[model samples]
Target: MTKDKTGRLHVTVRSGRKRKLSSKLWLERQLNDPYVVRAKREGFRSRAAYKLKEIDDKYKLLKPGMAVVDLGAAPGGWSQIAAAKVGAVDRKGRVVAIDLLEMAEIPGVIFAQLDFLDDEAPEKLRAMLGGGADLVMSDMAANTTGHRKTDQLRIVGLVETAAAFACEVLKPGGAFLAKVFQSGAEAELLAQLKRDFTTIRHVKPAASRQDSSERYLLATGFRGQQRP
Candidate 1:
């Protein structure tokens, strides 16, 4: 980072001989991202914390005494925010987290190293929560194959699965939030969400990069409708 003539700060990462150009670019982006610096200063797990905070701030999705579930909560960024907002640290609410990767453990969150698609996930999360949840959020993304259509389908598939699980475990009037791509949900999935939830919308937080295709799907007012 350096200051130029006008005193504006600039950061550029020159590609090293051994470092791939892609890696250098990614590193440069991270270096220039203000949210990354803010997250480090605030002790949040990742810059993604701000993405949830921005959504929840505007939507008021999280509240004290609201049980929440965070799927694919590795590194626990969203889980940390959810725990704080719901007062899980004070035992006012519970946060049950599921991920295939291990997490370092947050005070208000109970974690399990298991795939969310596992047959027993719903029951296990319910038992951990002692009942239904007020919200279920996921930031999970499938490994990209670099094919645009295939990647888009993979993203929507993850959202659909998470939404279905949210319906299964959320109490009536609960909410669901998950990452979706620019393509958004397919017609059939969108129709299913409309049937299950009172409202559905797309959100893009300031923390998300402008050029990125990532967006969030927020569905609120779960009807508790039975799903086959």
Candidate 2:
């Protein structure tokens, strides 16, 4: 069970006569969600698009003609926004998106269907990009195992792997973005980002559920090979 700002428990066991209650409640919440309504009205693939938008707004990291890689990009919301914002005119701007799930094709973005944890994934991504990236954004979250600590660790591993890949491929002064739950594991990643980047901060977008613990880490000014 999670507690909201009002200090009320927002989740309950779905047992006996309440077996369907939890699912129904979730559906009700999604239907009534303002972000969901806005996403539908605006024809965005998912509400998660606003998360990247807000982060980019604060950090001023996105710009025209930048080479970007989107990790765990499924259903194509972030990729769609990135393709346009990065200036895909005549493919001068490049956006490469990868995920384990099949995604509907978004014009002007390269989509790779592969698990990022696979050893071959990075090579394939670079092959698609034809060079290193200027920005690597990861919304990758491990599939939840229902155990709190295990789930947290799994996501931390995902974030760390993405960050390591970014360090290898991002240009000097590049940016890296990844999703993280507000957990103790974030401290180590934050510390590492601070060491390699000029600035690092956590951001929670308004499009995110107010009750959710999810937040984004924005790291800019990649030290790259210059790190002492």
Candidate 3:
């Protein structure tokens, strides 16, 4: 580790014979990332906590007494921010998180280990929320297939599924936020959201790596349920 002229600490990773190029690059990025260092200093679960923090700072999507549902919430980074912002610790709000992978307990987050795609998951989450949710957020990403087009399609499919679940569980005039890629395939999803929401916006927070194609779709003021 060494400080550059700008007073920024830089970490260089030496790739061993056993370490793949991708793994070495990823480790180096994590080690030098300011958000990762900040997250550790603040005791957050992961660097992802800063992404949600930056979004909520601008949009005010989280409130003191809202009911929030976090889909694909593993490692509990987003859930931690939601719990604190929504006052879940004092029982003034509710935050329910679900992911296929098991996560360690967060102080005020109600976590369930289950696949969001399962038919039973929606009803179970609704019950846990005690009714409709004020906000539904998803950071789910599908497994990549290496082909760029195929990967984009898979990401769109995952976002569509999360949006459908949000439509079913969000209260009238509630909000939905989900991670999406910048690929052009999002047109269909945006069209659908325009029909269902009063406002929709795409945002790429500073916490998101500049080299990454990731962005977030934020839709607010749902216009009630739509029948197909």
Candidate 4:
């Protein structure tokens, strides 16, 4: 680590001989990222917490007593912010997290290690909430295959699935937020959300890397499904 002429500290990865170029660059970025540093200092699980924090701070989507569900919540960074914002600690709210990988326990958060696309996952999450959620959010991303088009499709597909599940499990007037790459492939998903929700928009938090294409798609005021 060395201070630049501007007095900003910089970390350079010197393990190039043992690490692939990609791995070395990623390690150096993680080490120097201000959000990662702050997350460590603040005791959050990961730097992702700031992404959600900045969005919710401006939108005021989270409130005390809101029932929330977090999808793909491994590492539990977003869950930590949601738990505090919704007052989950005192039971003033409920938070249910779903992920294929196991997540350590977090107070006021109900964790179920399962694929959210499983046939029973939606109903199962609703059961855990004892009814419906006021908000459903996901930071899920599909694994990349190194091909840009294929990766874009996977990201959109995952977001589409998460949005569908959110529609099923959220109460009337609820909100949905999920991470999406800035791709035109989401036209169909956006069209569906426009019909199901009263408002839709994209949010990019400062914590997200500036070069990344990621943006959170937010749909609010669900109109509720029709009942026969």
**Tens-digit lDDT string for candidate 3 (1-228):** 788789998999998999999999999989998999999999999888899999999999999999999999999899999999999999899999998899999988999999888988888988898888999998878999899999999999999889988888888899999999999798899988998899999999999999999999999999976221
Query: Candidate 1 has what TM-score?
Result: 0.95
Candidate lDDT (C-alpha), each: 0.89, 0.83, 0.92, 0.92
lDDT of 1 at 84: 95
For residues 72-94, write the lDDT of model 4, one tens digit per residue.
Answer: 99999999999999999999999
Question: Which residue pairs clash within candidate 1?
Answer: none
Candidate 3, clashing residue pairs?
none
Error of 4 at 154 (Å): 0.7
**Which ranges of candidate 1 are over 4 A from the true structure?**
4-8, 225-228
**Model 2 error, position 195 (Å):** 3.0
Query: Stretches of candidate 2 above 4 Å error?
Result: 1-19, 226-228
Write down the TM-score of every candidate: 0.95, 0.86, 0.96, 0.96
Give the per-residue lDDT of model 2 (tens digit) for 111-194. 888877777766777778787788999887889989999999899888988998788778798889999998887778777888
What C-alpha lDDT, on a 0 to 100 scale, does residue 65 get in candidate 2?
82
Kindly list the per-residue Cα lDDT of model 1 for residues 1-228, writing each as its tens digit: 797677867698988899999999899888877899899999999999999999999999999999999999999999999999999999998999989988997998999999888888888888899989899999998899999889888888888888888888898899999998887447777888999999999899998989988888899999985232
* Candidates 2 and 4 compared by TM-score, better number: 4
